[model samples]
Target: MEKKQFLYMLKLVPELLDEKNWTERETAIIGEHFCALEKLIEEDKLIMAGRTQNKDDTTFGIAILQVDTEEEARYLMENDPAVAKKVMTAELFPYKVALYNPRFTI
Candidate 1:
């Protein structure tokens, strides 16, 4: 099955987790998101996701998400625990993407 693709940009705030005194709860929260997000990806609902790895680890300086539509973007963003608890804030906008196949070169 072929699915539509849409690009979205999301920014995160470090909150207390990125602090020097971070707690296990914070780690668990992030881990939970990772697991949930992976499930979405495996199902092909999530096309792509990227985040910045800053030295300070102040959360993703900026993150990008690829979904199907603006509505889907909004729903996914809202569902993210990062946004649910102010750990991150999502600034979403629909965008177009181009895919390339580098496998067949002649």
Candidate 2:
């Protein structure tokens, strides 16, 4: 039962130069998005996910996903609160896990 998986890069909406500070509403949306991602991880759909740490740039997040097809990966991204709420946009790509520690296997 080896299903093909994909790697998706989720890019957050670029912060406005004038609006450098993140509003409370934006913070809330990100929090909810993380919660949703946590649930996906628990369900074994997401192998790993994390955000970029570049504070002075257009920071984005990356996720390793397990799905039956690329279409499913697109659907998952579209349904994510971050994307749905306009906090982020995503692009999916077929990927192969060439090397990794067994403890990190999905």
Candidate 3:
């Protein structure tokens, strides 16, 4: 099947920005979130994933994926540990990568 690109943006629950609200469970789920993204990268399903440095309401994260269908893309986004467990919420959108610099790394 041919693949299409999609992007999912994630926003943290307002309380998450305050370190006082972090419990072991929230920390573990975040760890799982990173692991999930790593797995996607290894499988070639993820093009890139990152977040803003700010800790305010404006802060957000994004993951760009290449998948066979929107349903698959939604599945991936909805299943992200942070999203699944409600540590964060996400919105999906069809996306196109208009330009990229091969040497850029972060």
Q: What do the candidate models score in CA lDDT, each in turn? A: 0.62, 0.80, 0.96
Q: Please tell me which predicted candidate would have the highest lDDT against the true structure.
A: 3
Q: Report the candidate with higher TM-score, 1 versus 3.
A: 3
lDDT of 3 by residue, 1-106 (tens): 6799999999999999888999999999999999999999999999999999987889999999998999999999999999999999999999999999999767
Query: Which 10-residue window in model 2 sums to the lowest lDDT?
Result: 12-21
Q: Which stretches of candidate 2 lie over 4 Å from their true place?
A: 16-19, 102-106
Best by TM-score: 3
Global Cα lDDT for candidate 2? 0.80
- lDDT at position 11, candidate 1: 53
Where in model 3 is the C-alpha error above 4 Å? none
Model 3 collision count: 0
Candidate closer to the true structure by lDDT (higher is better), 1 or 3: 3
Rank by TM-score (best first): 3, 2, 1
Candidates in order, TM-scores: namely 0.68, 0.83, 0.96
